[model samples]
Target: MIGTALRGIFTLPDLRKRVLITFALLAVSRIGFWITVPGVNYDVIEEIAGRQAGTWIDFIGIVTGGRLTNASIFSLGVMPYISASIIFTMLVKLVPSLERLQKEGPQGYRKIQQYERYATVLICIIQSSFIVAWMTSVTAGNERLVPNATFSFRLMAIVSMTAGTVFLMWLGEQITEFGIGNGISLLIMNGIVARMPGKFSMFISNIARAVRQGVNPAKEVTELAIFVLLFVGIVAFVVLITQGQRRIPVQQQKQTRGRRVYGGMRYYLPLRVNQGGVMPIIFAQAILMLPIAIISSIPGLQSIRFWFNYGTFWYIFAYVLLILFFEYFWTALVFNPIEMANQLQEHGNFIPGIRPGRRTAEMLEYILNRVALAGGTFVAFIAIVPQIVSSLMGYDIFLATILGGTGILIVVGVALEFVQRVEAQLLAREYEGFMRKPMRGR
Candidate 1:
């Protein structure tokens, strides 16, 4: 099936073009990941990163694909843009004016996008400033990451990082316009996947070291096998949840027009179980990082740090609560039961055993809440898998992240999205799709 899909993809001129464009743009972005901001020493930053494993520094590296580790021009990556989008998305719901603007159709959407761009720039400036100051302050045995931290250097870093992010934003937009899959997501997934080879190598090297020391490498090897099995199970579980949906049967009223039946059909409205996707996890992680960072930075607050530490009981509890909260929060923001009900009513469609107005809306909200709770619980569980693996398996947090958890979830989600996109292109052109039998129609 994969081989057939590969052939089918390149067989079409337009699909081939989109595929090539996506790869080309992704290659350019990958190159930018290595281009450091001027005057920052990559070697020193890497050294500091090594010593600071399991901190927010490592988290940033994992998310941005090593760009932050080098203080690269693209260090900010697409996160600032993502952050801007998330902020504006919430605003559009909470702010009446923004909500009105959102209802104005494509023109309003474009305006909101413009505002998000402006916000992205402002966020980049604020974030980059802190990053610059932090990097210059980081010292390794009398050697600073930024040797000469001058105003000029700060200015250059700020401009360089912001420009890099803006360019990446533009590149992602282009990919959305002309390429296959979501550009920004593809970029992020690529970043995560790019680091995998090195991590797997490190895991392998650790096993070899254990064998040499006669530390009973058998246990570690057993762990590796278990890891693979767990990974496959988790992936399958993710795909199932990601694609899971509740199909609400809707009936259209039969209509008579000049002795001809104009309507009367039954179809299902598929409401996804995990409509919020990875947003909940992303939001929870961002919010969780703050308290730990703030508390750890304060003098004499070291005793309280463990309370907010990643794997601690209180920390995990709060993290799970946040995930559940944000799952409903984001779902409420994006999905409107009222709107769905209105559309169904206007079209003379009604859910079986439910009225076409407020009742339908109420039912939808009820079902959505239940579905979202399940999804939220699943995501919260996945989020803590890394912590569990790190503690129980005795693997480095970085290594554990790749083996299972948010990293694998994002990788799987994005990969599935990408393949589905390519498959869609193939199906549109009457070609067989990846991991699917040939359809009867184009």
Candidate 2:
């Protein structure tokens, strides 16, 4: 496998360059994770964060690739950009003007993208300001997170963080254009994955400590084995679901004109089982975290914090329900059977055993609805189970995240997408490229 990958990497000059560029850019991003924001004490922030582990802060830190906890310049990460894009996306669906612009083809698409960029900057300013304010207010047993709480210091911090986020967004775009994969997704995945080595080390150290304390090493080893097995299984499951699709058969009518005949063929339109991909989970996480962020900020909500506390039964229950809801909601937005059927009918195609119009549309919707229900449930279970297990085991939240169902799904989904792109490039160049058979007779 390693040799094959290396050969593939070196096969094309452009691919090799793209892969190199992606790694270099990611390295720069990781460096930014350690560069702290001015005026903040790392120890105090760490202490506060540790005490508040498993809260919204922890989730944000994971998403930012550990930047938020470090109080770095890139603390905001690509979240502001994601939030901005989502806002614009929702607006485009709801507002007629934006919808029209969206349908206007390339020029219109560029205009919307420009609007998204503007909105991203605006969101960056707002989110950065709030982050700065929140950081300034953090205290660890009377030690201020930011020692010098001055207007100039706050302004600098905000500007630095916002600029860092904007730069990261630019880096992601560059990676998409000139690198190997989906840049933004890779950035977020990098953040989630960057902590893996430390997590493994922690687990090893914990086992050593347990053995030193006369605990049964056998039990611990067994638990570790189970954890590894579960992680692999979940990754495999996610990969399967991410790649799974339902192919609807379509038969085209034959056309004959004089000496020419056309359009007699059968093909299938593939509708993925998990059409919404990770968006449903992302949306659900953001929504669930919002309340935690708000309550963390407002002291008056302290009394009710117990109910909303991370790892609590209520929290997990709510999280699962929300994920399920968003899965269906997002699926609806992205898939419309009626429109699909109309287009197919207009092209003189029909699904076998189903009427060409409304009936086919209904059948498609029925199949989609059933598949979506099962997929949504599976995703929700995958997301919640790891959190529940980690909380019970008292292990590192970071480890839980990687071992957690959602993280594995994202990693598998993104990795598969990257591989598919590589395969497509290879296939395109093949014969003339790789996977070609020799001609039998010239």
Candidate 3:
């Protein structure tokens, strides 16, 4: 099945071209990963990053495809754009003027996009400035990452990093216009995947060290097996939840013209179980990082940082609540029951045993709230399980994270989306899809 899918993908000229363009653009993004910001000693930065493993920098590395560790020009990655979009999304829901603009259709959408771009630039500047300050301040063994903590160095770093992000944003747009899949998501997923081989090597070394120390190699092997099983089990569960949906049947009104019936048909609307998808997790993670950042910056607050530590009980509790909150918050903003009801009425279609206008809208809202709750609970569980495992098993947080947390979800989600996209293209060309065969066995 996999070989046939690959053959089908390469055989189609348009699809192949799009795929190639996507790879080329992603390669360009990766180039920035190796190009560090000037005036910084990367060796010192790398050592500090190693000592502070599993901190915010590592988390940033995970998000940006491992560029933060090197303090590269593209260290900011596509996060600023994502943050801007999320902010605008919230504003559109809260501000009546933006809401009105949103209802104006394509022209309104374009306007909103322009606003988002402006917001992205602003965010990039602010974040890059903070990074400059942090890098200049951090030192290791009398050696500083930024040797010269001058205003000129700060200015140069800010402009270079921000430009790198803007270029990445443009590259993502190009991929969206001329390539395949979502460009921003593809970049993130690419970064996460690029780190996998190194992570796998670390996993092996961890096991080998335990055995060499006579710390019961059999127990270590059992743990490895458990991790594998847990990873696979979680991935399977995520895929099921991600793809799960409820199909609401609708009946179209029949019309007669010259004794020929037209329009009478039954179709179903698919309401995804996980409506917010991965955004809720992203929002929750961003909000949860605030406490650590605050504690680290303040002198007296260092003692209380453990309360907000990643594996602490209070931290997990707060993280889960935040995830649940954002799940519902995002769902409410994007899914409009009233709008859907109106569209159904205009099309002369109605759900069976339900009225067309207000009642149908109410029903949809009720269903959405219930499904959103389930999704929120599932994601929250997935997010924290790895932390709990790491705390209990005394394993590295990075390893546990890749095997269990948002990283796997994003990776699996992107892979599924890419496959579905290729299958769609194949079907559009009247070719057998990845899972569909031309002939059936009797």
Candidate 4:
């Protein structure tokens, strides 16, 4: 199946070109990850990162595929840009003036994008402060990571990292223009996947060692087989949740022109079951980290950090609540039932039995609530279940997430989206898509 898909992709010239461009851009970004920030001792940076293992720094590195510990040029990754975009996206939806601008189509979108870029630079500088403080901090024995407390060193670190992030932003835009799937998402997935191979290799070696140590090899093999199957099942479940949607049927009223009849038509407005995508989990995790980071930093509050440990009851419970809250919060911002109803009414469309105005808005909002509940619940489950299992297995939370939890979920979602896009391009050209079976009969 995989080989056939490759063949299908290579069979088309345009798609092959896009795929190559995407890979090239992704490679360029990865290369930047190794370019250490100027005037910082890479070894000392590593030492500091080592001391802070299992903290937010490590988590960010895993999520973004950036070498923060190395004080690399791309240490900030695309996160600053992503943060800026999310801020601007929510503002665009919430602020009436921005909303009006957004409704103006392509030109408006371009204008908004320019605003996001400006915001990205601001966010990059703001975020770089924390990283710089961490990088320049003097350790217990007088060891210094930056060694230079001078203003030039600090200034360069900030400028270099900010530029790296902006370059990534531009690279992502280029990929989107001349490549497949979404450029930013593809970059995130690339980062996540880049960190996976080493982890997976380690996992396999551990499994093999355990099998060798076992008195019953066959039994161990069976258990490993079951674990593999369960992993596949979970991935499939995520795919279903990612792609699931609640489609509302709409009917358009018939209209007649002077010499022609037009209008009466039926279609469905599809709302994704998981409308929030990874944002809720991302937000919940990030928000929870703040208090944990602060408490851990305090001299006598280290004990309190234990409660916030991954897979603990309070942590999981709070995590679930945050995920649910952010999902609804995001849904409310993105799904405006009143606006939807107005659009439908303008187009002479109605949701069948539902009236065209306030009633339709009411119906849509009600349905959206139900959909969000189902989606949020599923998303929380998908997120928490892996952490619970990883904790039970006594694995490091950092390694576990990179191996399975939110990390794998993001990879699966992005891969599925990318495949769908490629398939769309293929089908549009009267060619077999990725899933199209090869003919075997003579």
User: Which digits, one per residue and each the tens of the lDDT, describe model 2 over residues 1-442?
Assistant: 4355457677788888988899899888889888998888877866875676666677776654546767899888888888877788778878999989989999998899888888888988898888888888888887889999899998899889888988899999999999988998888888878767766676577689898999978876777787788778778777777788888888998899998999889999887888777677777887767777677678787655678666677878887888778888887777888988999899999998899899999999998888788778878877776676676876555567776555667677778777766656655554122333322232
Candidate 2 lDDT for residue 283: 78
User: Any residue pairs clashing in model 2, and if so which?
Assistant: 429-433, 430-433
lDDT of 3 at 244: 91
1-442, model 1: which lDDT tens digit per residue?
A: 8898899878888989999999999999999888888898766876876777667766765665545776889988888888899899889988999999999999999999999999999999998998898888888887889989999999999999999999999998999899988888888888888877876687577689998887978876777787778778888988888888899899999999888997789999998887777788777878888776787789998767778777889988988999999989988989999999999999899998998899999999999999899989888888888889888878677777775556677788888899899988888777788877888574
Task: Report residue 355 deviation for candidate 3 (angstroms).
Answer: 1.6
Span of 10 residues, lowest total lDDT, candidate 2: 431-440
The Cα error of candidate 4 at residue 318, in Å, is 1.2
Error of 4 at 80 (Å): 0.6
lDDT of 2: 0.78
Give the TM-score comparing model 1 with the true structure, all chains together: 0.94
Q: Give the TM-score of candidate 3.
A: 0.92
Model 1 — which ten-residue stretch has the worst lDDT? 58-67
Q: Please give each candidate's TM-score.
A: 0.94, 0.90, 0.92, 0.89
Task: List the candidate 2 regions with Cα displacement exceeding 4 Å.
Answer: 64-66, 210-216, 292-304, 391-398, 431-442
Q: For all the candidates, what are their Cα RMSDs to the real structure?
A: 2.1, 3.3, 2.9, 3.6
Better of 3 and 4 by TM-score: 3
Ranking by TM-score: 1, 3, 2, 4
Can you tell me which runs of candidate 3 are displaced by over 4 Å? 64-66, 100-107, 207-222, 291-304, 439-442
